[model samples]
Target: MILITGSTGFVGRAVVERLLAKDELQCVAVAVRRAGPKLSERVVKHVTGDLESSTDWSAALKGVSAVVHCAARVHVMEDTAANPLEAFRNVNVQGTLNLARQAAASGVQRFVFISSIKVNGEATQRGQSFMADDTPAPLDDYGVSKMEAEQGLRKVALQTGMEVVIIRPPLVYGLGVKANFAVMMHWLQRGVPLPLGSINNRRSLVSLDNLVDLLMMCLKHPAAANQTFLVSDGEDVSTTELLRRMGIALGHPARLVPLPASLLELAAAIVGKADVAQRLCGSLQVDIEKTRRLLGWTPPLTLDQGLKKAAEGL
Candidate 1:
């Protein structure tokens, strides 16, 4: 049996679907604070209260051999919490540890954690890609919390012999995706002319299906035990290229207006959006060779194919 958290979320929903489609997996369960109508009939749903350090998970961990933890305090453009780091730690670190410890005690064999690239750093310098073993340099509250969770999970593994597999992926995009990816898709569908043409920074992104496929493999693969893997579509693209491709998916040519990067940065700074501008103008690439070498795994879909899928859904 496999128990997945956040089954109603974007990535979590995809994970649940993939798991249910496979006959070998047998039984599937979901941990949710609010059980939705769509999931109750399909999986064993546990409507535990809010995710916190004190949240009881005894009812959810029963007979579960593995866990796919995808729940977290996601990144936000404007943080409402008085202490954003503490808010993130409440769910991402303490809550995550709570679940892992319980799972370990309950004889759960393996855990697959869905972490973010921010656990490495916000962005990389030109020609410098983040490797799995690089010293962690998390920049934001969410990243710091995830890094702490990784450390905590490793410690749990040491004490209880539970195999922990961590996957640090870049931006994940696909059907039913939200936030920045959704906004970009909405604009691309309307053929909106954007001012992000000249940016040439390479950003690595993982399609939702590719990441889910890796998780499915990790559930049973022996090589995935107790390892941190960096994964992507193995194709890095510039902001311009990404926009252009999304345009293709939307069946329209990208109407990008090129503006100098420096001037754009200056304009964003004047408008109190320097942080947003920095994300758009920066590079965040991951080197997934270790993942490939260790697990002998490859993304099932190429970037173009993934784009086509996204386009068709759009």
Candidate 2:
């Protein structure tokens, strides 16, 4: 049996659906915060209230051979919590370790963690990309929490002998994508003129399908045991090109104005949208050579194919 957490979330839902579709993998169990409508008749559901250090998992871990942990206090634009780091740690770190420790005790073989590229800092210099072995330089509370979780998981693996796989992916987008990706799609669909035409910085992105594929592979691949991997679509594009491609995918060509990058940055700062502008204008790339070479894996969907799927959903 395979166990999955965060079965109702964007990534976790996709993982559960994909696992159910497979003929070889029969038993699929999901650990959700609350009981909702059944995802499928075959799925076993366990209601584990809120993710924290004390959540019980004995009932859910029964007969489970592997675990895909997708639940997290994901990064947000403006966190209202007074102690953001502590809040993130409560879920991302403490909760994760709590489950992992139980999984190890229950004799689970593999634990796959869905991490983020934010663990390697927000941006990279032009022509440089983050590698799996690079020293972690998490910039924000969320990233720090993830990094800490990774560390704790590593220690658990060393002490308990349960293999842990970590995969850090940059900007995932697909059919049900939310946040900035969705906003960008909305802008393109409305033919809103954007001032990102002159931004030449490159960013790496992975489609939801591609990420799920990697996650599935890690479940049993011998090479994936106790390994850290970075995943992407194996393509990098500038913000302008991305907007343009998305516009085409949406059947509305992007209306881009050739505004100077500096001026755009200035305007964004004036409006207190500097962080937003940085994400749009900065370069953040990941090298997935380790992923490809170690797992002999390739992203199934190309950039255009992923964009088309996302566009169709809108």
Candidate 3:
């Protein structure tokens, strides 16, 4: 049996649907914060309100062989919490370890952790990419929490012998994608002129379908045990190109203003949006050679294919 947390989330919902489509509903269970209509009637559901260090998981972990942990206190643009790092740690670190420890005690064989590339760092050098084994250099509270969770999970693995597979992916987009990716799609569809035309920095991205595929592989692949993997679409593109492609996919063709990247950065800094400017003009890439070589895997969808999917309902 497989137990999945955050089953109502963007990624977790997709994972659950995939399992159902494979006629594995009888073998699947989900841990949700509350009982709701988001899940199907046929699949097992367990309500384990707001993940934290003390949440009970014995019921949810019962008879489960593997676990796919997709829950986390995600990053936000403007955090309202007084202690953001502590808040993140409560869920991303403490909650994760609590569940993992219980799962290990229950004899769960494998644990698949869905981590972010931010655990490596904010950006990488132009030609250099983040490798799976690179020293973790998390920049923000959310990233730091994830890094801590990874460390704790490794310790649990060493002590309890539960196989833990970690997968760090870059920006993930698909049909139901929200946040910055959705905003970009909305802008393109509306033909809003953007000042990202001159940006030439490359950023790696992985589609939701590709990420889910990799998660499926890690579930049973022998080579995935106690390994950290980086995943992407195996293609990198510049901010301008990505917008252009998204525009094309949306059938609206982006209206790009060829503004200088430097001027844009300066303006953004003046407005206290330097981080936003960095995301738009900076480079962040991940090398997945090790993932491919070890798992004998490849992203099923190409960048164009994934973009088309993401554009479908936008």
lDDT of 3 by residue, 185-220 (tens): 998898899988899899999999999999999999
RMSD of each: 1.2, 0.7, 1.0
Estimate, for each residue in 5-120, the C-alpha lDDT of model 2 and write its tens digit. 99999999999999999999776999999878977877999999899999999999999999999999989989899999999999999999999999999999999999989999
Supply the global lDDT for candidate 3. Answer: 0.94
Error of 3 at 307 (Å): 0.6
Instruction: Report how far off residue 299 is in candidate 1 (Å).
Output: 0.7
Model 2's alpha-carbon lDDT is 0.94
For candidate 2, the TM-score is: 0.99
Q: After superposition, how far is residue 170 of candidate 2 from its true place, in Å?
A: 0.7
lDDT for residue 65 in candidate 2, whole number 0-100: 91
In what order do the candidates fall by lDDT, top score first?
Answer: 2, 3, 1
> lDDT tens string, model 1, 1-314?
89999888889989999999987766689988885675535588898777799988888999899999998888898999999999999999999999999999999999999988899999998678999999999989989999999999999999999999999989888877778888887888888899999998988999988999999988889999999999899999999899998887778888999998888899999999998888788888999999899889999988877877776665
Better TM-score candidate (1, 2)? 2
